[model samples]
Target: MLAHIGGRGFPPDEAAERAWATALWERTGGRPSGAPVARQIDAIRASGDRTAELRRITAPTLVVHGDRDLLVHPSGGRATAAAIPGARHVEIAGMGHHLAPGVLDRLVDLTTALARTHGARPATTPTPTPAPAPPTEEPA
Candidate 1:
């Protein structure tokens, strides 16, 4: 999982990877299981092309992909965006299959922009404010 997340031009973030690993361990009760992952991969492989179906989608679509993604090449994203009529494609730099440190914020911004463009209103619930930055210590 770490290898897949960090490879393909994305530098390894040890802290983030360790946190993710811990989360996964907690979720699965520390059981060594490859069946689920294998099944997902097999299912993806078994699914045939759906270009015609993709083209039939009428809703506004946004395709965001990492240019450096090794799991699925950027060309696949390009092809998907091309198939969907009026689908906007955004290629992010220095990202892989998994979300890196700064990618989440960028994704959120892109999603918000797309939603606003499509006349979607923001949720009524108040958004959480970020914590104040720590004061820098001065050198004596």
Candidate 2:
């Protein structure tokens, strides 16, 4: 998924404020005196703390979290999966707070592995029941 970060989840508060102000200025065709998307920007800033909401995801998922991700935090990724019914979590050994170039490949590989293991089930067949035989003439 394409990320347009503006704080930790988006960018830092200052950067988000600045970026939003700049974008609003640009999009408004230079309306130099305006609210400057302040409310929208504040909402974006508040979205960084979404651990509880993420846990509610019920779809099958594979999470690859960087051990060094200060922004999102490693525990968040772990908590996300644990909250979901059957979600899987994968921690990358050398990943950082954010994905570097080609980081998607690692995620893809992780999800692929999860899908393979999750989709595969042991072969199961019911054992056949033998019919009862007639009683022998043992009594005299």
Candidate 3:
């Protein structure tokens, strides 16, 4: 579960994994308790479908998902983009549920571009030219 939820895209970082695992263990009662985790799972299950509420969101939205995410499946991101008007969905290849160290710069670039185009507050990261979309073939 930790492997799937944490960085599954890149090579394992034992130090980082240990740090997060320790922090999570401490948060969930130190001696190992699944109650908090169970409650979270229950809450998510109880939330029901929220398509109508998602449609009501008017802000410029970006839905970024990992193509390899096993924890939340890539389809969830697609559905979210479909529900929200004008929401742009981006699926990063080789990414899982967590952001691997290698993808950080690319994410920063993508987000910076989004913020700039939307006229949001200035971003500290210098925005690079956004990657061009892959060309699609039209049926003749």
If the candidates were sorted by their TM-score against the true structure, best first, what order would they fall in? 1, 3, 2
RMSD (CA, Å), each prediction: 14.0, 16.1, 17.8
Error of 3 at 40 (Å): 1.7
Pairs clashing within candidate 1: none
Tell me the tens digit of each residue's lDDT in model 3 across 36-138.
Answer: 8799999999999999999999988889898888889999999999999999899888788877677788889888888888998854888799999999999
**Model 3 segments beyond 4 Å from truth?**
5-8, 24-29, 123-140
Candidate structures ordered by lDDT, highest first: 1, 3, 2
Reference-based lDDT, each prediction: 0.85, 0.66, 0.84
- Compared with the true structure, what per-residue lDDT tens digits does model 1 show for residues 27-123? 9899979998899999998988989999998899999898878889999999999999999999998787877666778889998898999999867
Give candidate 1's root-mean-square deviation (CA, Å). Answer: 14.0
Which runs in model 2 stand beyond 4 Å of their true positions?
Answer: 1-41, 44-56, 117-140
* TM-score winner between candidates 1 and 2: 1
TM-score, per-candidate, Cα-based: 0.77, 0.45, 0.75
Give candidate 3's whole-model lDDT.
0.84
* Best-matching candidate per lDDT: 1
lDDT of 1: 0.85
Task: Return the TM-score for candidate 1, rounded to 2 decimals.
Answer: 0.77
